[model samples]
Target: MNFKVVPFKALTPQQLYTIYHLRVTVFVVEQTCAYQEVDDLDLTAEHLLGVDTDGRLMAYARLMQEPNQQARIGRVLVNPADRGHGYGQLLVQTAIEQIQQLWPETTQIKIQAQHYLDQFYQSFGFKPVSSVYLEDDIPHQDMILTL
Candidate 1:
């Protein structure tokens, strides 16, 4: 899979449409969770799109600088049809690398990860910083990686 890091303003209409589609399909429709998926963050966050050779969006994530002097990665997802391939892994590693490049002085990264993926995030050196809490009725925990 090829990955493209595009800021919100740089994303084309079709790309935006596909991103919203994939995110909704997995986070809402498939998970049966109802909440606001689209938000103000999309306006400032840089987007990571993992696309396949056939030009389909295989995975996606977002990187943004936060007010608390931390870089954040969020809205992470792998396309349902594209799951078993480690695209999520690549997506996250790429997000970290991009954060480093885009904000060199930043030394910490944060994620409000789904609770079930604790081990996965742990593998990347993120440790739980908050107790698991319900967000949109789904369990989530804040994890942080101190770089």
Candidate 2:
């Protein structure tokens, strides 16, 4: 998979549409979670898009960093059609690298990950900071990866 990190303003209209489409498909419909899919967060976050050779979006996440605050990784998802091919790991690894490069002052990265992915995030050295809790009715755990 090919990876690219783009700021919100740099994303083309079509790419933005595709990103939202996949997020809705996976996070809303596939996961059966109902809540706001598009929020103000998109306006300032750096978006990581992992695409196949054909330019098809395969994975995505939003990266955000603010002064004196830990960077955040959110809205992470692998295209349902493109799962099981390690794109999830690729997408996440790329997101982490991007954060480290773009915000060297950041001391950590935070994620509100689905409960099922707790171990997966742990594999990346993300320690659970909160016990399992419901977010939008889906079990989630807050995790932090210290840089």
Candidate 3:
């Protein structure tokens, strides 16, 4: 898989479309969630796209700068057909590395992750910082990784 990390303004039209399409595919259509998928935060966040040699977008995530010189990673997804191939893990690990390069002063990274993936994020050094809660009717918990 090849990874590309760029700001919203820098994303090509096709790249932008692919990102949203994949997010909606996994987060909304595939999961059967009906909430709004195109939130306004995308304009200020850096997007990471994981593409295959065949030019298919297999994974994605967005990193946003938060208050107190911290960063947040969200909208993480791996193509349904690509799951179990380690693309999700690769996507996140690459996001963290890119975040560090983009914001060297950042001291921490946060994620509002699906509850079932708590252990997955935990393996990447993220520790739960909030109790389980419902967001968009899906169980989630806030996790943090201090840099």
Error of 2 at 33 (Å): 1.3
Write down the worst ten-residue block by lDDT for model 3: 80-89
Per-residue lDDT of candidate 2, residues 16-86 (tens digit): 99999999999889989899999999999999999888899999999999667589999999998988988
Instruction: Assess each prediction's global lDDT (C-alpha) against the native.
Output: 0.92, 0.92, 0.92
Worst 10 residues of 1 by lDDT: 61-70
Clashing residue pairs in candidate 2 are: none
Per-residue CA lDDT of candidate 3, range 1-147, in tens? 999888999999998898988888999988889988999999999998888898799889999999898999999998998899888889889999999999999999999999999999999999999999999889999999999
**Which stretches in model 1 have alpha-carbon errors above 4 Å?**
none
lDDT of 1 by residue, 1-147 (tens): 998889999999999999999989998999898989899999999998999898799999989998666899999999999889888888899999999998888889999999999999999999999999999888999999999
